[model samples]
Target: MRNEIALTLQKALRELYNIDWQIDTSIIQRTKKEFEGDFTLVVFPFVKQARQSPDMVAQSLGDYFQQNLHCRFNIVKGFLNLTFPCQVWINFLKNNYTNTSFGYFATGNSDVTLIEFSSPNTNKPLHLGHIRNNLLGDSVSRILAACGKKVIKVNLVNDRGIHICKSMLAWQKFGNGETPESTQMKGDHLVGKYYVEFDKHYKAEVAQLEAGGMDKTVAEKQAPLMLEAQEMLRKWENNDPEIRQLWNQMNEWVYQGFAQTYQQLGIAFDKVYYESQTYLLGKQLVEEGLQKGAFYRRDDQSVWADLREEGLDEKLLLRSDGTSVYMTQDLGTAQLRYDEFHPKEMIYVVGNEQNYHFDVLKLVIGKKLKKEYGPRIHHLSYGMVELPFGKMKSREGTVVDADDLMEEMIIEAQNKTSELGKTDFEDGKASQLFEMIGLGALKYFILKVDPKKNMLFDPEESIDFNGNTAPFIQYTHARIKSLLRKAADHQINYNHQSFNEIDLQKAELDLVKMLYEFPQIVKTAGEMKSPALIANYAFDLAKEFNRFYQETPIFKETNEQLRDLRLHISQFTALVIKNAMTLLGIHVPEKM
Candidate 1:
């Protein structure tokens, strides 16, 4: 659509200038309704080439569109307004509205891309931070897939480390083999509690031992829980049957808990890579890099990568003990994925804090291969999702658990439904609606912001139904559905029906224009890799449709033919919104 508009304008300009020089028409702008045009073609850039005043260039273009082109045109303050023909826009909306693939990109043009996100440590249930990561990754993949990209969604689980040992130690000392069912707690939350318990007891034990005036290093190393956790890690690494059994059992519970939460939030991944598997791969990569001179060996026998030439400091690739740090595992994962898919691009949908880490990874990969064969690595750095008070702190226990947050949103949705006098819904209908509304609210809230901008997530302000929210869009859909059902009962078909353009008022024309722009919105969102753009576009369309609904009468029109045509348009617009919202990973309930 952008290309079409640009081409048309360029042709008009060429005719106006009567020139043979190459002309570019990329300086078009969207104009305000009150400013007298739908799009403004800036003529200031042409002033030098055309050797004419900006105002004269604008007038000439406006005159060209009116006299030589098929569309109407007007000029305001050295800006040419190109108003597309009503029939052109009407045809665009009708064609797109009737087709199932109206707002999506052309098929067979998708690039193979890998998207990695939602990397959580095994020590705790997912918190608000992970929620942002999950949504961004899932939404990015969806957006790319919508744009006809062969997107591979992956997750790297951080399941091994001292953090894992903390939970293991706590469970060993205090669990007494209590299962999640026995404790009546969600598996991940149950495990997380033990992790917190371990910290408390371990700190106390260390303090008590130190008070006895023992050597600092000896006292710390001999701390009972610390030593036990270390021993457990060693046993686990050595494949000790008893420790492996316990490790697998606990991790199974955590996986089950994560599955339930993911299902509720509508997130999925094509592959799951655990640190237990990838960390060793990371260590192996360090050894390979050292042999290849991609990395250097320190005096302390640690492996290092000097990225100072890349404007980064030296980084520890492998510890003196030959263990992988966070970065080593990332480099290994990149190689593993490339070996698997050979993707044209790899997008790590991580947080802004890891920007520097990815920079190092790219540098190391470049050095190791001595060629730019690392596939296009992009660190999709998103900002923190904060609360009204401040950042969510896990150790402070003030973090919003994803499960708990979803539950709260569900309850709020249920209460809203009841307030709307929807208490008579079927047995499971309310539960179904709760999931849709809750998840929709959660996704829409997050995706509505620019992914790079730090956003505040106030629990109280997250799910308003009256504003530019998921529920507002959902309600618009529900209303259209009800109206469509009524239209069906009345035996209406507007496919062949026609209406005069004279009746197209401002609100009506605004709606038609908004509906016509859905494809462009989807295209822009895909190109920019920003789902928030579509979110904003969806809300804008819904708002305009609602206004049109309040002011324009579809059912009450005296002309049956015209009434039927308007009804068809309304139904089609509703379908477009429903489909667009789905691309953004939002669900619309029938009655919200």
Candidate 2:
């Protein structure tokens, strides 16, 4: 409808002033609530083109629309406010109220986007920081898919490195062959415990050497534990039989642990890449760069890329001993993805800390190596998630475990749900509802904030049943479901009814208007890669529906047309809420 109006205005300009204007260049937006119109057009940009004052241009355009387009307008200074007749809104609702896939665009074969996220290391279990990354990546993938993009979600596992060797060495020396079955602990947690143990003993050894009249730097290098871990990494790189066996065993444990956590969080990946496998590709690329004079070799047998001319320092590609660095592995992974999928865009959903790393990656590929797909690389750098106290350290074991935090959320959900006397749930249904509310709260709270900003996640605050929380929106959906069921029991059939002649109340009209914006909201969210847009849209829609429900009587309305219209409006609002929440990877329960 807005497009039609814009086109009409463009034709009017051509006819009135013999001017050629593009429809897209015209500015049209939804009017503010304080204004008395459905849409507003800024007339200032066209005032000079029309050779008249802003008010005069607005009046002329308003008159044109009122006469030809069936739109009434009010002039507010330089803004021309336009409102359509009641039948226009009524026709909109009648046409789209029952659409199951209202806001989602269907993807075609040509649209392909590959998103890499949740790149977890096998040395530790998933932590709070990992939670934020996984949620943001997963939600962004859903949003993009909703906007008609063919999305391929992938995870790059850092399975082989010095960090993995640290945990392996600690377990070999301190652990007496204790397995996850023997200890009854999660596999990732068991591995993480040894990683912390390695750190503690390494630090003690350094401190002891420092107390023995040795420099701190030299002591750190000479520490027995640190040297042993480095040797282990070298042996693993050489594919030593014993070392390879241990590495495989420990990595399997961590993978099992990671799978459990991913299942709980409702995250899955289409492809998984191991750094150990991809690092060789990077090494090959480095060798090629050296041959092409894009990289230099040092006297110590190390390889480096000189990016100083590009404002970045020289980056190490291969160590003097022929081991690959993180950058090398990333390059290999990027090349592998491009070869396999040839995606239109390759987005790395990494944290803001790696901003410089991705910059170097792109520069090396684009300028140094001269790869065509290098410019397609995008770093979706997001802010960190912090608690009220401060930051979390993984080595010190102070970081919150994703599994533990999810369990706590479920317990909190149970307590809050019981307090609200919503405990009429049947045997197994109560547990399911608790999981829904708990996970919903966690996901929504983290996603509600803009992805570019750091967020403080408060579990208790997020689980509340009021004030812009997921529970509020979920409960609103449940309330509408209950009302629809009641209508069904009372034999109120609204499916075949015609609401074209019914007069919509202010609240009803407001809701229809809000629903009208869902498609645009989805498009904007996908363009910006922000799930917070959908999250907050769901909140606003829910708030509007609650206001409408309070002011309007549905079941008791004596007029059948009015009651049917209200029921259809209620049903449509619920559909929009469900669809929007789904984009955030959140599930709203039919019964809260």
Top lDDT hit? 2
Lowest summed lDDT across 10 adjacent residues in model 1 is found at 18-27
lDDT of 2 by residue, 1-592 (tens): 8788889888888887777887772277888888899989998878887899999988988999999888899999999999999999988888898999999998877578999999999999998789889999999999999999999999999898899999999999999998999999999999999999999999999999999999999999999999999999889987899999999999999999999999999999999988887878898898899999999999999999999998999999899988788888888888899999999999999999899999999999989999998999989989988766677788755687899989988998899988888878878999998898888888888899898888775533544546898989999999999999999999989886577677888889999999999998998899899999999999999999999999997988999999988999999999999999998888888887
Among the numbered candidates, top TM-score falls to 2
Scored against the true structure, residue 166 in model 1 reaches a CA lDDT of 83
RMSD of each: 2.5, 1.7
Would you give me the overall lDDT of model 1?
0.80
Error of 1 at 90 (Å): 1.9
Q: Model 2 reaches what TM-score against the true structure? A: 0.97
Every model's TM-score = 0.93, 0.97
Model 1, 108-179: lDDT tens digits are 955788989998887889988898889888888887887788999999898887778789778978989888
lDDT of each: 0.80, 0.90
Clashing pairs in 1: 110-148
Off by over 4 Å in 1: 12-26, 209-222, 371-375, 424-427, 460-462, 500-503
